[model samples]
Target: AQSVTQLDSQVPVFEEAPVELRCNYSSSVSVYLFWYVQYPNQGLQLLLKYLSGSTLVKGINGFEAEFNKSQTSFHLRKPSVHISDTAEYFCAVSAAGNKLTFGGGTRVLVKP
Candidate 1:
């Protein structure tokens, strides 16, 4: 079994400033990590994922995440955030052929 935890419940950042959303997981088996974003009144969108290969994974909208096996962490970062980046972010983990376990969402508010 696996569980995900998002460290922050809310993050506020100025527009064009760098931002990072922390995520951690616990599991006894290999798992896939994912980061999703949900804009206001919109469905979730895939930000990035760490399935296999390199530890550093890049995703849409200039977002990237580094998968750390030793720490069991996959943290998402954006060098510069825009007003459009304001949204709710979720961290998820799944074992092979199992359902995904999601962490409590983190809401990001971008200030001008």
Candidate 2:
């Protein structure tokens, strides 16, 4: 079984500031990591993913994450955030032939 944990429930940051959202997962088998964002009243959209190849993966909206296999962590980061970036972020893990297990979610509030 695989599970994801988001250390923070909410992250408040000023606009144009850097932000990082912590995510950790546990799985017995090898798994793929992903980050998704949900805007207000909107469905989730894929932000980034780490299936193979480079440990550092970049995604849309200037977001990026590093897959640390040993630590079982895939934390999301943005060098400079914007007010439009305010949304709910979710981390997920999926193994071969298995469904994705998502984290509780972290709400990012970017204030102007």
Candidate 3:
């Protein structure tokens, strides 16, 4: 399956709690990985990306991701997430292409 996997479609958490959204991919060729966050009725913002080098990559809003070739995974992790972090996260892949094939998306809900 040359597709992306978002292990959780919906995740509810208390405010200022740690959260991890799992992402795995199956592809024969190398691909560019990306994590994007989208708020309600808003466009996507690039949370992070694993482009060429570096197994561990950091991005905006205190989010980071690790690229694993063997496991074919690039999981996103945040030590402590805020209420503003509540949004829809999408994992995507693009192998030398501009178009991105996104997962179903994981919803992160932060409770008060």
Writing each residue's lDDT as its tens digit, candidate 2 over 34-63 gives: 999999999999999999999999999899
Write model 1 residue lDDT over 3-70, tens digit each, in one string.
99999999999999999999999999999999999999999888888899999999999999999999
Give the alpha carbon lDDT tens digit for every residue of 1-112 in model 3.
Answer: 3689999999998888889999998788888999999999999999999888999999999899999999999999998989999999999998665568899999999998
Ranking by lDDT: 2, 1, 3
Ten-residue region with minimum lDDT total, candidate 2:
92-101
Give per-model TM-scores: 0.97, 0.98, 0.94
lDDT of candidate model 1 versus the reference: 0.95
List pairs with backbone clashes in candidate 1.
Answer: none
Better-scoring candidate (TM-score), 2 or 3: 2
